[model samples]
Target: MLKNNKSDYMNWIILIGVFVLLLEVLFFNRGVIFSLFISAGMIYLGRKKSAKKKGKILFWGGIVFLCASVFNMMTFKFFLLAILLHFFIKYTSSKKNPNRVSPVLVEPEITKQEETVVVSKPLLDNTIFGQQKTPTGVYEWDDVNIQAGIGDTVIDLSYTVFPKGETVIFIRNIIGNIHILVPYDIEVSVHHSVIAGTTTMLDFHQPKIFNKAFHLKTPGYDHAEQKVKIFTSLVVGNLEVGRI
Candidate 1:
């Protein structure tokens, strides 16, 4: 209840700020919108928990400044500084989602294991968190249709699995790090291309091959095929490969 009251008060403050911005735009039309909107946007963006959102907010801000410039209202010099400020702020935004610093009152998941074939939203959202259980030891972990964030997530998993025939890990855009462990005797093929994480080869009983950031550690050239791919240049965070 105390937290709820705090949230309500903050909202009221934001509302007042928005009202002030509107009044500034009305009364001071020269460069008022630029200053007013930027101020309002900065405060709003400051409270946002997503890095992706900060970009959008900044992007819209650029559009506003660009529009102002095109109309011969604000100088391009002012526009550039305003845009650069927003771009720079995005770099520091999300090491984690702010609202999720602690477990909130989100409703619990009640799905059965059979129904829990995991599907992920943006991964950067409220997805890869809240629970982790011991893997079922039947060697069924490989080829498991696991869905990980394709975007920047506050927290993620590092896993290792070996499949009898084939294996796959579906990654969208994991922000931080990804470490995979495989059986030392299996021949594995990994297919992934992403700029967010650095993939490194590790020494094991198996032979390891790397192409640029693509790495595959194999006992020998079994050519027994299995693969995973992650899209590159994702609007997310970083990734690093390591052993579990």
Candidate 2:
């Protein structure tokens, strides 16, 4: 998966380089047209790769903005200001107080009849931009927390071996796509919060709502000895939970 991510990054870099070179050499006088074409191509490829509903909306919206830019229908300065304002708001909302104490987890009480073993590890605060891939084969972890700012994240647990109990995954994403692959034998549950996003879960049928929250779980999840629970918060992105 890491190798695949590197390859995808390299491909995007090459594509951008080629587009810039073409713009300088052949489309200097018609820069807007070139920009429109490239943006449209990106939108098309993105939709083809994920088929995400929110992604489609974002892409189509970009096309509309590009058209306005090309025709000078709106002030370019106002557009730039709006972009800046968006970033400002995002940055402000994500900020945390430095003096605030972090939460600590307490160990559960164990009875004499049963031995308590800690199988999961705590996940530190980590931020990822672009593409990220987890350890591929036979992966084992107690808990996972991820914050993805953009691009793609793939968590492949199909070949993993889970301990006898429950595992937890928490993910927050903005303008990104998260794909989780689990083994068919394992039970799974998902609780999702979406502010303009979408989620597709295996073996769960529910009407999708825009800018809303939903929960999904496989049958027999509550009684399954080995289970996984995923909690996700997404803003303008896609989340897919599937079996291998």
Candidate 3:
């Protein structure tokens, strides 16, 4: 009952606080927005003219104006008051409630039981600077997720058999090329993020891509039971997702 009452009071306090902030922003602090923009412009002009006397004046004037405008706002004053009140309450509560030893603190720690289970490793291992490729022959299928520093990754899905449901492959490389070959029958979804690279996915080709994110999916990807979802992130590299 006490906790519930406290929670209810907290909710009311939050709602009232929000209402007060809205009122301050709409009525009292209406000019703060315009003042902020003017301050920013003044700062920019000041920096551009910093080599001369006018630039320095503009910069210092903008800084002083921004500080004064921000400090004069009711919202800023309220925030400062709230922070001070919170610290005061916390300090008084700590002083009133002295720490006492409890059974939980003095109780002995229990030993945790250990059990070992064998787990198979993924086909693609993370490397710093090297080429990562799936074996040419038949290999057991495992979800591929690896992060590398500088390496080229090539995964041929044609050789391996995918299990039922969606198969996920995530690869993040700092500076490397990624190439994945998918079967024609399998529905594939590719989401790639690259800073600077060339992307070639099926028939769609991007010769030059800089700071771009691409999402491509087959037509029947939504309903397909067996589909591959590939997510690759590269800083400076090339990505190729071709149908075999």
Candidate 4:
């Protein structure tokens, strides 16, 4: 049954791909295929003859042509339409459900008093495009857990003192590197995963890793009282953990 389902899924994908190609040829730009091939040839030739002035022109021209071809394709039109349709549906849904009931509203008999509380800012704030580093001077120790869109994360354990038990540092990045500096006294355990990158944890070095997970640890990590446990994942990047 699973094999049949898989075959059906593949068939559907092939059919959809063929249909899209047919649409591109018949209804949309017919020369897009040729344009892409030409662009690729131009780019290859340009790289081969990179020292000459004509190579520079070919490189830039190929880039421009590729962009033009992509933008004029049926797929791009579908992408734009999908974006517009998504926004339109979202706006309509928001307008219709303006007074959506919360979980608290469902429990009518339970009355609770509202209390004011102070919220402290986290040490490693989430960012899209910037480095997240530990403070240089003396600062309170906090468990680092942040999701970054595209940036390097640097955590230095030398500045702040760690509490007893396991100190966790969890980081998730779409496209960035993770570098952690740990003191020699502190035992460390790392669980790092990457889609396409490398890992350099202490003396261990994985030059080219793809879609793999690594579990590394100091010999004393299991029994150390003030040890740090790092969990990091990246879509396309590197991981490096070393002694400070």
Candidate 5:
């Protein structure tokens, strides 16, 4: 249920992938069909992740499909798609397109007075309690303190409230995809230097930090900069760097 643990998640993917491959080689000899089923199953299971996450399922699925496809060019579509999409993600991810964008998260600063006064606005919490399924979740952030307990709790921080001036986000145990959204026209500075995950800056450079992870981005040179400073550190998790 808790989807933030990176090691566990990757292990699941790998385990399932290898299992699927073995099944393909032994039982279901439909070429990419095995990979496709495994990937699709994972995606369906992780339907709650995100748009990019869904893509990742397919993406990694494609990676597994490669081995099986080698023997059968009959399913050229799967092979071509896997190679093309994998490279496409790699190319676009590495090349750094200034025009591409990602979701925006508004981390609000809670003054003492504001904290005392409970606003009636909706918050992005991880769970919809009492419901059968949490198709939509909200966030509520008093602060992302480095408490050992809350480390790998994949927060739906889409609606988190962050302090002004400077802040960095951290992940402890789980491998999660931190989805951050910046407002259009807000000159917010961004940085993501964390271990275990890649950083991508949708419209800017990677965050300056000590051994940062993956995928971090902010407004590129084409856009105006903000006065407020924002720093994010995902000690563990995928930093899906982008601005859209």
Candidate 6:
């Protein structure tokens, strides 16, 4: 409840700021209103036509007009700085959390039966930045979570084994590219949320957008004995899933 209240308060503050800015633009800088209208029209046309190139053109043009209306470039610079600072602070804070769990590599355990042998692999929870590649070979894991902040991450599970029922992998990325390689035999499903990015699963492609959510699944995902479910959130990045 307290968190909700705080969020409401912040939203109100933002609304008030927008109201004041609107009043100022209408009274003190009427020329800006015209620029805004033009920008809006361009953006609308671009969206209607599904032309990303046109959208980019008008978006930057709108920013230029908005900056001119606001008097100087300092505000824009400050806004960008604030955004960077916010992400930096958020990243550092997450790393510093006392309850945060660190990832560890585990080897498979072997057990012998009367006439057979069995191997049980450990689950993996990895948080990585920059470029990384998953260990290659046959293995089994229960739950895998990956946090890739930047650069590229390649995960190949072509030869791995999954336990019966649902196995989950969670990924959070920012300004990075993730490529997941899965085998054809196992069922795979992906639930992804992207902001200003692209997601490609097999032959399906999701173009970059302001915000988009995608759910992709292979055949037999629902009733398959062995299934892999991947939940991913990406910001300003790309995610590609392919067969091995």
Best by lDDT: 3
- Candidate 2 structure quality by residue, lDDT tens digits, 1-244: 9589757856765565566545544645456655655554554445445468776675666656656655552234434555676587657856853347789998869755866887655433456556777765555564788787656778888656688899889988765667899888999999988755457898553344457888889889999999999998876567889988
User: Which residue pairs overlap in candidate 4's backbone?
Assistant: none
Native-structure RMSD, model 1: 18.6
| TM-score for candidate 4 | 0.58
lDDT of 3 at 59: 71
lDDT of 1: 0.42
lDDT of 4: 0.83
Give per-residue lDDT, candidate 4, residue 199: 96
Q: Show the lowest summed lDDT stretch of 10 residues, model 6.
A: 42-51
Clash list (residue pairs), candidate 2:
120-142
**lDDT value, residue 188 of candidate 2:** 95
* lDDT by residue for model 6 (138-176), tens: 655557676765456677886677777988888787645
Residue-pair clashes per candidate, as listed?
9, 1, 0, 0, 42, 0
Q: Report the candidate with higher lDDT, 2 versus 4.
A: 4
- Per-candidate RMSD, Å: 18.6, 16.1, 12.0, 8.9, 20.8, 12.3
lDDT of 5 by residue, 94-181 (tens): 6785556898997869745533666664222332111111113444444333322112233333344445434444333232345555
Worst 10 residues of 2 by lDDT: 73-82
Better of 4 and 6 by TM-score: 4
lDDT of 3: 0.84
After TM-score superposition, the amount by which residue 25's alpha carbon in candidate 6 deviates from its true location, in angstroms, is 11
Tens-digit lDDT track of model 1 for 163-187:
3454444544333233444444444
- lDDT, candidate 1, residue 36? 46
Better of 1 and 4 by lDDT: 4
What C-alpha lDDT do the candidate models reach, one value each?
A: 0.42, 0.69, 0.84, 0.83, 0.44, 0.69
TM-score of each: 0.32, 0.50, 0.55, 0.58, 0.29, 0.53
Runs with alpha carbons beyond 4 Å of true place in candidate 5 = 1-174, 204-210, 213-228
Q: Give the per-residue lDDT digits (tens) of candidate 4, residues 61-139.
A: 8778878998877777665665676589769978998976756546468788999999988999989876778888988
Candidate ranking under lDDT, highest first, comes to 3, 4, 2, 6, 5, 1
